[model samples]
Target: MTLRLVIFDVDGTLVDSQADILASMEAAFAEIGRPAPARTEVLGVVGLSLPGAIARLAGDESDDRLARMVEAYKTSYARLRHQNGAASSPLYDGIRPLLEALHARDDLLLGIATGKSRRGLEALLDTLDLRRFFVTAQCADDHPSKPHPSMLLTCLAETGIDAGRAVMIGDTSFDIDMARAARIRSVGVTWGYHPAPHLSGADRVVEDTAALGRVLDDLLELAT
Candidate 1:
């Protein structure tokens, strides 16, 4: 049995965090005394690090304002999580089962590569009782934002998995591009924030968890 590492993106991939994300973005802009970007605009940057996402959304703002907005967003997100608990960012349908099934495979190792800060990711995994599913987790705090390949490369290194034996599964172009840069295969999921068309670069594009499972089996050569 060959060892394989499967890395996942968090927001919009494993979990449906659009509501909280948009709410936090709105709060961040409000705290900076600026109007929030449109809903589409906010969702468009879901896979980027907070600072990078905010910078893109508020490109004209100074670095100070961007930093302030980032802090505000973090505060607001924490508050929302406290208020709504796990419901604030529920796992997408079939994700838990898919993860469990994958985790059961002795030859496979699960990991995370997300734009979330380490603290944020930890809190989320704890709240959702999902920390045990992953062997190694990579976050925005330790690397450059997605599309840079830093996170994926780190995940590969930490797991001691070769790029050819690993696959990145995510919902955004950033995820696919990052995997490409890292010389790894990728699966783009359509049920998340990015439209399916945007995922054309991925080696495989899946419409649902069922399709994703099939694709993963094929990509990783897992026994059915």
Candidate 2:
């Protein structure tokens, strides 16, 4: 059996966090006495770091205001999670089963490469009881945000997995581009924030978890 690493993006890939994300964006902008960006605008930046996302939405804003918005967004997101518990961000359908099946494979290792901050990723993992499913988790705290290769490179370094033997699974172009930069294969999911058309660069684009599993099996050459 060959060892392979499977890296996942968190927000739109592993969990459906759109509601909390949009709500937090609204709260953050409200805290700064600014109107929130449109829902489509917010969702468009779903796979970037909070700072990057906010910067894109609030173009040309002062650095101080951007910092404040980031802090306010964090506060609002934490509060929402506390108030709603796991319900604030639930795993997508069929995801848990797929994760369990993958985690059980002796030749496979699971990891995370997300734009989420360390604190935010930890909270989600703990809430969903998903920490055990991954062997390594690389987040925004230590690396440049998505679309950069830092996170995936670090996952490869930590796991000693060859780039050829690893695959990145995500919903956004940021994820696909990151994997490409890292010289790894990518599997894009369409049921997340990004539409299917945006995932054209991916090695494979899956519509659901079942299709995702099959693509992974094919990409990683796993025995069926």
In candidate 1, stretches whose alpha carbon ends up further than 4 angstroms from where it belongs are 222-224
lDDT of 2 by residue, 1-224 (tens): 67999999988898999999999999889877999999988999998888999999999989999999999999999999999999998999999999999999999999999888898889999999999999999998998888999999999999998999999999999999999999999999999998899999999999999999999999998322
TM-score of each: 0.97, 0.97
**Native-vs-model 2 lDDT?**
0.93
Inter-residue clash pairs, candidate 1:
none
Q: What C-alpha lDDT do the candidate models reach, one value each?
A: 0.93, 0.93
Displacement of residue 10 (Cα, Å) in model 2 is 0.7
Clash list (residue pairs), candidate 2: none
Candidate 2: RMSD to truth: 1.7
Per-residue alpha-carbon lDDT of model 1 for 107-219, expressed as tens digits?
99999999999988999999999999998999999999989999988888888889999999999999999999999999999999999999999999999999999999899
Clash tally, candidates in order: 0, 0
